[model samples]
Target: MSTGPGADSAPAPTTHDSRSTPEKTPPPGTRAKSSMFSSLKVRNYRLFFAGQVVSNIGTWMQRIAQDWLVLSLTGSATAVGVTTALQFLPMLLFGLYGGVLVDRLPKRRTLLVTQTSMAVTGVALALLTLSGHVEVWHVYVAAFAVGLATVVDNPARQSFVSEMVGPDQLQNAVSLNSANFQSARLVGPAVAGLMITGVGTGWAFLFNGLSFVAPIAGLLLMRARELHVVQRAPRGKGQLREGLQYVAGRPDLIWPIVLVGFIGTFGFNFPVYLSAFADDVFHAGAGSYSLFNTLMAVGSLVGALLAARRGTARMRVLIAAAVAFGLVELVAAAAPSLWLFALLMAPIGMFGMTVNVTANTSIQMGTDPAMRGRVMALYMMVFLGGSPVGAPIAGWITDAYGVRAGLAVGGAVSAAAAVTIGLFLARVGGLRLSVGWRHGHPTVRFVPRERREELTAAA
Candidate 1:
């Protein structure tokens, strides 16, 4: 790949160069340094990135405030779970249709509408809280509205990244996006906690409501001249079914989606567990709750940065990370003290990000440009849609078994899922697992030794 002033001006190279090239031309499979932050070189992406950073910080703040508010009002773990479920239920019900809409519409326009809708929802919630008349049912209604917007917003946003950076730098752009989200996660909760303690939760919601202006402004400011536009498919019959078939045919896409569904449904429902840990297990207040999330975000930031440094997405990395994530959660559940539980959060965040970044990068890289929106919609369904099913179950478990046992159940389910899926892939892919460290980096060779011996015996 060549990196130069005209990098975006000139069309992407049609064929790989075979001869030894100059330093400016990176070797095949090796990305240029410029590619690490290449999307920023595009004016549109720069605006989008900046806008999302501000908006995402507020989004995180609102999440913490909302959870805290629910707990304060009801003092029920199951209530918190119900709120979360109400918020995500829309995605579970209508996410596929939302994806089809994204495919049929202009992503920028879709985002503008969704962002505005979300801002309105936030403002309403803040107003209700400020009036001191907020009720649990009011929160429930608002949560559902936010979730409805999310079902549309998520697919539009995921597909929008490819248009911003083009295919050449898609992996880098996606990794950086994850990094931005984690960075916000690190800052948002701590800030929200302080703001809530010093002022009120209403103010946190107000801040979130105002934050949408940045992204809206960024959307308005985008230089449409620079976008690498994908041709929209004509409205046709069975579009949703087509997307499903397309993904079902590819094991690489299918298995990861399955894995994420299991992880999201069984292991990643943090609201229920976090609330229980804060109120019941540690007897800590909101500050400690925010601190726990901040620590997890710190580890997530590290994971995202490491992912950004990589040039390619590999399937084995996804599998290993999923297994590691599950095990870490198990350890966290078993911790004897608050500090130990917080400590385990770091590895949990790290491996969780690894699974997410790897799966996201792979799905984007592998999909056809025309089908990107729909494919990503299906991906979101597996990712976020699972939360509705998982949150209530997690909450009930936390209510029944105590927080520790609830968390342990989630971890055990996630671990079993990873091992089962990983082994199934090995068999289907004809892989044997062997381990060694190459240049100090651990490596697993997937082709089985016995399979190799059998082939040799036949020969």
Candidate 2:
């Protein structure tokens, strides 16, 4: 693959050249050097990364401020939950349609519009809050509007990665993106807290509103000719159904998504679990809850970095990560001490992120570029949409039984789903369990059925 900024400008050579230029030639130990940050070598992806760093921090700030503002306004936690629900409601209702639109439109242009809309919502909210005329309804309206924009923005941004860095760097880019988000997550809340107490929420909102300029400018500055543009899907009816059918037909595509659906619905309820564990189980209060979140964020950041370093996404890795994520949660649910439970949050975060990044990269790598938008839309829809349905069940379990039972049930469901899906995938792929010694160590893993006789004879 070409690494230079001008590589896209030249036509490909018909044959291999022994005399490649130094600029295009990779170093002797290129793998070690490039593993963690190979995607940033692309000029376009670098711009996107830089822009997102600024924008994402601002976004996290807004999220903290928004929830806090809603709580203050109504003095009701239920109202705060309602506001959170409104932000995600649009995606649950219309996410697939948004995907169809993304496939039909130019990704960069679509993102510009969506980002602008989100910025407008932020600025409007800031003005209202600053003027002392803000109402709960106005905050609700802004949240919904931002959600509406995200419906289009999420898929567009996801698909656009391929354009910026091409297929070779897709997995690394995606992993880095997660790292970027988690990094912002670590910093944004602290900043928001400072702004809220020292100044007010209005400045945080204003900062978020203006952060859109970074991404918008990045979009404008990107070189159009360098992007690896996919052919846009033509305007047509039944496109949503077509996307669904495409996923349904491919076992490789469908099964991972199904696994994610179950896990996402049941396993990813960290807020409820963490808070309950903090207050009810340990009686450690809000400081402990915040500490738990920070540790998890650190683990998530580590997980993303590891994924990027690995530079490949495999189904087995995804399944193993899913299993580990579940088992870790189960162990943490029964942790005897507050410190032990808090420490376990790190591994839980790491495994959860591994599952996320691995599944995302595998799905994208396997998908047709033309169907990329819709497929990602479905993937995100299942992942994000499941939260609403799952959160209430989790809450009910916590309220009725206890936090431990609620968490244990979720972990059991996730681990069971991973095992079932892993076996099914192995079967479909014509593989069987192989148990033996490899080199010196004992080994047990799935292997191709055709290799069974060869392995037995060798043994």
RMSD of each: 6.7, 6.1
Which one is best on TM-score? 2
Full-model lDDT, candidate 2: 0.87
lDDT of each residue in 119-151, candidate 1, tens digit only:
999999999999999998888898999999998
What is the TM-score of candidate 2? 0.93
Once superposed on the true structure, which residue ranges of model 2 sit more than 4 Å away at CA? Answer: 1-34
TM-score of each: 0.82, 0.93
lDDT of every predicted structure (CA atoms): 0.81, 0.87
Q: Highest lDDT: which candidate?
A: 2
**What is the Cα root-mean-square deviation between model 1 and the actual structure?**
6.7
